[model samples]
Target: MSGITENTKTSGEPSKENPSPNSSDTPDDEKKDDRMFECNICLDTAKDAVVSMCGHLFCWPCLHQWLETRPNRQVCPVCKASISKEKVVPLYGRGSTKQEDPREKVPPRPAGQRTEPEPGSAFPGFGFADNGFHMSFGIGAFPFGFFTSTFNFGEARPTPAARGTQQHMEEQFLSKIFLWMAILFVAWLLLA
Candidate 1:
């Protein structure tokens, strides 16, 4: 049977239309290859594509063509690994689902939609400071800590605390520190 028919027979599930050791079809070859992740750069089903040391899959010729153009400084388009033409395999085989997909672990965020740090539910006045959403940085990457955490006192100029202003000059600096220190000392003694 042709590869087309074999593929159609097992659309969602993987199976051979007719099992035969001598059959020349995709099903028989399927066992040999399990990695079939598509290349993001070139659009093609690379069965024998050379797998870069970075674990990215690419067609041998296509990868070769890419590296050939820039021989001395060859880098895998997906993983940016320094690869040489001689090191690349002439062909690759389909990969298995059991094999890890780098894309999933390093899921590409849409432009600026990356994860940010938002305050947890336990936190009331502290969280990410953004226009919308509760603000949660994805996984471990968080930029915005709180949307209202910013101490902006105006809808216009964010900073109106002119250093030269009389109010600023009169601002109590030492008193605030003394008061807090005394409060801390008392609290500590009480707890002790």
Candidate 2:
């Protein structure tokens, strides 16, 4: 890629009004080499470069800002292909320093994800036992069992408490509460 100093004036400010004399004078091969690494968004040499699945290149910071601009609609800035933070691949070129950490910037590019291979089928000896001795219980008698336990069906019901006792009054209050609750539930069911 073309170095930043190649386009800068002696004062260090980038030349906007006049094209750099050396830029046109440079060989076409060098220009093509420079363009290959230039970010599609900023149109400059890509720093912290990343490539979209659509094969477009961009600076990580520029691409991140583009994604932030329309979070609901993440697309490639160049090809408009479906793109996301996880899908972009970071470009690590030769001479890039390993000591320089990418996360120093906000919202670092996602690291490449690797998946483990699928496990093979179970072993032959690991199969279920072959004794042919299996025992199973059925719920076909569940309703009868539940009623027998709860209401003691076919047996005598408990006798009621004598009138005016505290236990009798509490039982009466509970019965009234239950009756009102059942009535309200039935009314709700019908209305609904």
lDDT of each: 0.47, 0.61
Q: How well does candidate 1 score on lDDT at residue 178?
A: 55
Q: Which stretches of candidate 1 lie over 4 Å from their true place?
A: 1-36, 89-192
| lDDT score for candidate 1 against the true structure | 0.47
- Candidate 1 per-residue lDDT over residues 27-62, each given as its tens digit: 646644332335435766663345655556665556
lDDT of 2: 0.61
RMSD of each: 16.9, 19.4
Query: Which 10 successive residues of model 1 have the least lDDT summed?
Result: 132-141
